[model samples]
Target: MTVQFERRTDRPDAEGRCTIHLRAYFEGQRLRLVTREKCLASEWQTDKQRFRRSKQGYQDANDYLDSLAARVQAAYRQLRTSGIEHTPEELKAALAPPAPAEKPKPEPARMLVVLFDEYRTAQSARGMRFNTLKTLNTSRNLVAEFAAKLPKGLTLAAYDMAIHDRLLGFLRHEKKLAQNSIWKVVKHIKAMLAYLNRDRGMPLAVEPKQLKAEWVDVDKVYLTAAELATLEAAKLPVGLVRTRDAFLFCCYTGLRYSDLAELREGNLHDWSGARVLRLTQAKTRTSVSIYLTGTASALLDKYLGEGLRLLQVMANQVMNRNLKEISKRAGLRELVEVGDYRNGQDGQATGAQV
Candidate 1:
C-alpha cells in the first residue's frame, strides 16, 4: 500500500491557492480523495508530499500532510493486522477522518436567576399548583439574594459541598431561618440542578443526592378550645367578621383554607337530619365527608344557604393579616417556644409570637 500527495495547480483559486489531494495505490488499484488544505503551488512539494520549509506556515502545513500520511499508513497496518482482504478504496476511505462537527455557540453565562426563571417556566408547563409555585418562588428569591452575595455568582455546573455549606450557614446564622425552612431552600436548589442537568443538558458537578434534604420536626401552634371560644365570642370589627368566621369554620371542620375556599352550597348535603360537607379537596383532589359541627353547620347555613356564594373567604394574605389582628384583640398573646433540629443538634426558639 502507498499513500501519495498531489497539488492541483489546474484548480488554483484567484488567490493562487492550489488544492491538495491524497492518492492510495494497492494491489493494482488506485483511490484518490481531496484534502481540505490549500497552499500556493510554489510552496507545495509533490515529491516530498509536504509544503516546502522555506514558505510561510510551512511547518504547520507540512505537519498536517505528515499526519494525514501517517493516518493512511496506520489504516493499512490495521487492515493487515485484521488479516482481511480490502480494496484501495476501502483503505482510502478508512484513512479519511470524518469532518469535525460544528460546535454549538457557547451559551451566555448562566446565573441563578436565569436558571430559576427557566425552572419556573417548566414547572408552570407541568401545571404546578399555585401554592406550590408560590413556595418555589419564595425559595428562589432567597436563593437569588444569597447568590448575589457570592463572589463569582451561582453557576449550575459549580454547585458543590462548599456552596451548599455556605448557603446553609447564610440561612441559619445570617437569616435565622429554621432548619426546615433551609431544607425547603435546599430542595428548590436540587430541583433546579435536576432541571439543568437532565432537561437543559448542562453537565452538573454535584449529584442530586449530595444536597440531602435535612428536615426537622416542628411543633405547630394551634388555637386551643378556650382560645378558640374567646376568638368566636369576641366582638370583631366589621372587616374581620369574615376572617373570624372562616377561622372558626376551619377549627370546626378541619378543612384547609384552600378546601374551604372551594366549598359551596352544592357541597353541603343533608344526611340523617344533620348537614355534611361532601366535596373534593382542591389540594389532594380526594373527596371527603365532613360531618359538620353545630358551629360549622350554623356558619354554613348563614353563608352558603340556598343560592348564596361560598363562604365569603378573603384573599389568603388578607385573611392572615386580619387573623393576626383578631388574635391580638382576643388577647391570645402568650409567647410560644418552638423546637427545631439543626445540624444534628436540638435548637429552640423562645418568645416567638406570630
Candidate 2:
C-alpha cells in the first residue's frame, strides 16, 4: 500500500482554506480520508507533501501529517499480521477514530393534536395564508374532537385504516359535515402527516395515501349581473353600506376577500392612460393586475379618505353575516338545491337560499 498526503484545492471553505486529505492506494483501489489540517493552496509544498516552512505553525502541521502516515502504516501491518484479506476501504476504516456515543434525545411529541399544532406553527412561520391556517386550525380541532370520542385516545402510533374509517364516519354521521367539507378535513390531516414524515423525518404509523380525500363537484352560487345591479340600487341601513360596497368591489375586480382586506391606496396606479389595481395574492403569492372598471373605480373613490387602506374591509365573519342580510333585501332569495355524492353514489341534497 502507498499512502500520500494531498492538499485538496477543489474543496475550499468560505475563507479559501482547503483541507489536507490522506490518500491510500492498494491493489489498484484508492481511499481518501480528510484530515483536521487546513491551509491555503500557496502554503502547501506539492514536492515535500507538507506546508511551506515560511508558513507559521508549519512544523506542527507537518508533524501531524507524519503521525497520520505512521497510523496508516500501523493499521496496514496489523491487518497483514492477522493473515486476512483486506481492501483499501478496510484500511481506511481501520485508520478512522471511534465515533462519539450519541446522547439520548428527549421523546418527541407523539400525540396527534400536538403534532398538528406544531405543523401549523411551522407552516405559519413559512408564510402560510391566514385563511389556510384557519382551515388547518379547524382540522386540528376536528381531530381533537374525534380523538376525545375514542376509547384509548388518538396517538401517532394508533393512526391506521381503522382510525381513518372511524373519523370519516364521525364527520359524515355524527357531525353531519358535507362531503366536500369532510374531504377538506381529510386532506389537511394527510398534509400534516406528510410534512411530519417527509420533511421532519418522522416515521408514519399510517401512510397518507391510505387516507383518501374524496371530493364531489357541487354547484357554485354567485349573484347574476341583474342581481348585482339590483343590489347596487337597493337601499341599505347605514351599518350594512360598507360591507355591501366591499362585496361589490370583489364582484367587479374578482379579488379574493383576503386581497381586498389588504388592498391599500398605493396599490392603485395609473398605467397606460388607465387606472389599475395591482397586488400580490395572499393565497397563491402571485402578482395580479386588474384594470379598474367604472363601478369598481367609483367604489374606490367613495372610500378615498379612509386612511391608507383603500377599503374599510371588516372581519370576514361579520362581513359574511351582513352579506346575507344585504342579499335578502336585494331580492336574491331564490331557493337552490345543493347536491353531494358519497362512496360513488348519490347522497342527500340540501336546499339553500341564495
lDDT of 1 at 184: 80
lDDT of 1 by residue, 31-53 (tens): 77788788886787777778886
Q: How close is candidate 1 to the true structure, as a TM-score?
A: 0.57
Candidate 2 lDDT over 160-222, as tens digits, reads 898899999999999877787789899999999999999999888799988986788665565
Candidate 1 C-alpha error for residue 11, in Å: 26
For model 1, what is the C-alpha lDDT against the true structure?
0.76
Candidate 1 pairs with clashing backbones = none
TM-score per candidate, chains pooled: 0.57, 0.56
Among all windows of 10 consecutive residues in model 2, the one with the lowest summed lDDT is 335-344
Q: Cα RMSD for candidate 1? A: 9.9
Worst-scoring 10-residue span by lDDT in model 1? 335-344
Off by over 4 Å in 1: 1-104, 124-131, 144-155, 158-176, 220-222, 301-309, 312-322, 334-353
